[model samples]
Target chain A: MLRHAIALLSGGLFGSGLFISGMTDTAKVQGWLDVFGDWDPTLAFVMGGAMIPMALAWWMRSKRVTALTGEPLPPAPSKEIDTKLIVGSVLFGIGWGLAGLCPGPSIAALSYGGPGLYVFVAAMVTGMAIAPFVRARLDRAVPAE
Target chain B: MPIDWIWGLIGGLLIGTGGAVYLLGNGKIMGASGIIGGLVDGSGLNTKWERILFLLGVAVMPVVLYPLYRDVDTHITDNYWVLIAAGLLVGIGTRIANGCTSGHGVCGMSRLSVRGIVATCCYILAGGLGVILFRHILGVI
Candidate 1:
């Protein structure tokens, strides 16, 4: 119960931060991405400011075995820099630039976002729904490492 | 109304703190794409209820704080097909790659994770090039 509450608080804080920073605004995101055409640097600050506390958290967690909730920490980070990551990132960037809504903001913006946002999320979820099948099929064809 | 860098910084800090809270207290990564992506891709099946509750918590923030963003226009493109295409790409790409801005860009970079940095770079570069292509060359922003 306590862990769940913490999760809720964390998630809520995240959502509020996204909203307060104007991340939920689609134009703000595209404006930041538009480096060549009237660039907006506000979003950059958002990332910069966010990094400070997060870095500290990582440093602190290195000393601990479990979280405040007694749950184990996440697994070690992956060191591999493979092709799938790059290709997928490239694909995601195109979509982000096109629509200006990444997953975090997309979910939060569902409240007041118009029909366009609705369609985008629906399509995104649909895409997600099929990803496992694709991965499974790929695994069967070629044993993953 | 244009360059609110200070607010961005403030919000980013809050965002980071939120992530920190989740990480330190819940022992979880506050990665939006990873959290939601895992659910759709079968990776988070063992923790579905937690995921659902986390998402509900996220979704409710906007509703509760609607007053702040009441005037904000999300600026979603007017084109429905375009929206669909964008959404599909975000979904498939993030799942296949395993991260997004929050996952790899923010939290990932904070930890100095090579995967996070690389993924973030790829998407940022791609998004920039994409803007140049669609918005500049094709005039289809």
Candidate 2:
């Protein structure tokens, strides 16, 4: 029960960061995306600021054994790059350029109450739903490690 | 440019701190991507409440804050098709990469996973390309 509360609070704080960072605002994000026009480099600073906690969290976890849950936190797994990665990256770039939205921001935007966010979230969920099947089919065509 | 750095710092701290607590308390990595993905999988009854609440919190935050911080505008000017495409692409990317920015950039990076390091590099590269392609190559700017 307490664990669940902590998770929710953590997620809330993360979402709040996205909201406060102007990341949830499409225009601000689009401005960042518009590197050639105004070339708003502000998002870089936002990203840099955001990474601070991430770095600290990593450091803490790496040195520690048992977490607050009394369970050992394992190190992350490693994997090689493959075709799915390349193709998915290209598609992600195209989408990001076009919509000026990423997963965190898109999910964060839902709180703002807009039709676009709704559509975007729906599409995002649909894509997530379809990914496993697509990956399976692709994997069969080209066995990867 | 419009954002207040102090607010961002505070928010980041809270997020990081809370994430750490959750990690310590639950033995779970605070990765939003994995949580959301797990929710979709319908794993078990024990996790349902927490999953629903977490998602609800994510969805309700903006609405909760809109009244308090009325200065910022949430309006958008982009075309619908573009936004839809972008969302779909991000979904695919998250799956293919085995994680999203939250997973790789936040949780994975925190654990010092080599894959996290590589994935984050790819995320930044993709983001940079996205900025250049949209603003320069396409002249959307």
Winning model by DockQ: 1
Scored by lDDT, the top model is 1
TM agreement with the true structure for every prediction: 0.94, 0.84
* lDDT of candidate 2 over B70-115, digit per residue (tens): 4456555446766667777777777766776666666666556666
What docking tier does model 2 reach?
Answer: acceptable
Model 2 TM-score? Answer: 0.84
- Report the CAPRI category for model 1: high
RMSD (Cα, Å) of candidate 1? Answer: 1.8
Would you give the TM-score of chain B in model 1? 0.92
Global lDDT of each model? 0.86, 0.65
Off by over 4 Å in 1: A136-145
The TM-score between candidate 1 and the true structure equals 0.94
Off by over 4 Å in 2: B2-6, B41-46, B110-112, B135-141
Q: For residues A59-138, could you state the per-residue lDDT of candidate 1 as single tens digits?
A: 99999999998999887898997766887898899999988889999998887787887898898998788766655664
Q: Report each candidate's C-alpha RMSD, comma-separated, in the order given.
A: 1.8, 2.9
Q: Over the stretch B1-141, how does candidate 1's per-residue lDDT look in tens digits?
A: 655887799889988998999899989988888889878878888877677777887789988888755457787789888888899989988887888999898889999999999999999898888888888998887
- Native-referenced Cα lDDT, model 2: 0.65
